[model samples]
Target: MKALRISAMALLGALLALTSFFVGMGVGVRQVPVPKAIPAATPTPVPTPETGVDFSVFWEAWGILEREFYGEIPPAEERMYSAIRGVISSLGDPYTSFLDPKQASVARQDITGSFEGIGAIVDMKEGKLVIVEVIEGQPAEKAGLKSGDIILKVDDKPIENMTLLEAVLLIRGPKGTPVKLTVYREGLEEPFEVTIIRQRIEIPTLSYKMLDGKIAYIKLREFNEIASEKLKEALRELIPQKPVGIILDLRGNPGGLLSVAVEVASQFVDKSPILIERTKSGQEKLFKAVPGGLATDPSIPLVVLVNGASASASEIVAGAIRDHGRGILLGEKTFGKGSVQQPFTLKDGSELRVTTARWFTPSGTAIHGKGLTPDIEVKAGEGEKDVQLEKAVEYILGLRREGKSDVCEGCGKQP
Candidate 1:
């Protein structure tokens, strides 16, 4: 079986679409590079079984088009690439996609979290480009872009029939330049226009502060490369303060590297299985927690905050903590994105990102298309304060008062 690998530089809904892979490690804002001409290589013949249908019709059509078509015939290599894409599309799995050389390069930039754009995460839902999140302190947030805003147009051009990558390319531009967007918000009767100047966005992974009640508040924005290290630093600083509880905020975080997910979960879950991976061949692999975690002390109460936008690596960590009785999950159901994607680089520098496996919580709950439900489901009303965070704080304080640090066994069991 192929090894499961996550994109090293995936963005969370900041580039094209708000799907798990798109936000976690697939989309980015860098301009696609020009395709370079390469030396032709020998074609590998397709092997057909004795009972398989003949593929002569396809070749016949290609031959006829080359000989008699009036229009300029595309190169055979280009046509082959299109055929490969069509084959992948037949799988009906959006996460399994073919990226041209240019697209692959752009994807690499996405996970790096340094690009020139409005810095808003977006997703394609019901044929519309919807905003999933706005990176805080970025141009999109400063310009008042909010989640659930449907993008109708870019720069006065309607985005009809355009793919997420195409829309992303149009929205991203050089720094200090303005990109106009028309969006339809949930409460508004009509679509409105917002012009935002693009800038180089460098997304911060994590932040921590001591709250009023001696509770440490740590907001993890993404499960990128620096996430684990930053978390360790935060624990080093705040744990010494002897905080009674810890509130981990994973709301609106799209996921990134899978290894980073395990590292993040290890911080709270002591020597236990953080995640389980089941491949196509029915082989199960366990990702166990490493020792010497900074926050593995079971006496420290932990509360994790999640929402509809929390996905992939976010769900992994949340589910692990909840399963191990390490923390209580608060807020809404997570964005169910449990499949693993591994990118295979083709000879021509393009990539085929294929789904290789599905991950489950230690308690054996599958999270694909069905997200993790929170222990305390606190829904936030429109224009309302963060009732979820407040509830987490309240729960932590109550636990402190009761002299309880861990949730009871079998609490918030998987349905």
Candidate 2:
């Protein structure tokens, strides 16, 4: 059918792209420019009923199979499904996936608040499964899995030629089940195996406390599916304390869902736009602050916390506040991952995550590989609070006093 042909063509295009990537035959990072816009995904078309000689060509091989096959003939449905799978596998984008009924159900469960697994965000780096971010308090983190860790094997299965998703399926399983991961650490000369028992992991979204009883300290862990809800709950509890200022921490938060980030930013901005999603056709979708969204007043002094690991949606929120002059950023440089990844499902229930567009700040500054510079830079230290947080608190309180006697002299800056 025409629709089937078109679908196959599109799928072929994707396959060609991925094949080039794997062959190391594609353009380099600098040569392959980031998408300036987001292209809308094409709608899948319906196959048409075959007729006449065309119909004969369609099942020519199937008819031969039934007539000449020595063993019991296979069902037509199974053959059809196999063809569909073959087409999907040709695409080569592991994140772009197709899920059958069973796999789809498992994927839904995995996206829920908790799942049994070694908590880690994985990506294909140099043809190997690389840990992007290990969830805090999870098995991987507790087992000393760090960002950029290279996983060479799981049990006896070497990860060579396997995609990131394939590695994930091999590693994650029922709670209390054991898995051995062979990894190559940066400073270690030998590859070591870490045996870990999988457990149900509930990702923590927000961590908060009152710093010096006045500055509300909030560290947003990540913008997962439920992050915005958790953020509102955290703020509801903290706002009543009447803190002089708030430190919105986004250090090491490898961003989750974009919607979660938009919702979280809405809480602090009332009458201004938060971000704009620009599509390939130059269509811009503006995410604006909801009416009366005074969850935090603009007049209330504010400081944003960021570091090397703050990326994607974290950068979005930080860039929004910094560009709008809603708050001062305080920390070292951030992880510059400003592209948006849109997940596509393939026929085999795997996912193809493709970077669709480069995100820009409100002021039109690109944050890709060029993170936000802090208004006040602070180097972190052991046995002391993060120097960034300390500076933000001191800055807010000092500004409140406006040149009165210093309250905390050890902070270097006046008060």
* Candidate 1 lDDT by residue in tens digits, 1-415: 2223432112322472223323343211112233344455433244357636456667777789899999898888789878978898799876787778866666555555466778877666666777777777888888888888888999999986555555666777678999999989989889999999988877776888999899999998766557788899999999999999999998877677677788888889885788888899999988889777888888998989988878788888899999888888889998888877776767778877777788889989998889898888899766757788788888889988898885855564765
lDDT, each prediction: 0.73, 0.58
Candidate 2 minimal-lDDT segment of 10 residues: 1-10
Q: Pick the candidate with the highest TM-score.
A: 1
lDDT of 2 by residue, 1-415 (tens): 0000000000000011111110001100111222233343332233334522343444667779878999986687567656556666686533334434443344434323455577765555567866656766778888988877888998879987664434555776778989998998889989989988887766555778888848888887655456677777878888888777788987656555566666777777653556665655676656666554445575567778877656667777777776666677778887666655454444444333454555667666777658777777787665545566778777888867784322232221111
Per-model TM-score versus the true fold: 0.87, 0.67
Model 2, residue 372: displacement in angstroms?
Answer: 3.0
* Superposed model 1: Cα runs more than 4 Å off: 1-13, 16-56, 66-78, 156-166
lDDT of 2 at 18: 16
After the best TM-score superposition of candidate 1, give how far the Cα of residue 274 lies from its true spot, in angstroms.
0.8
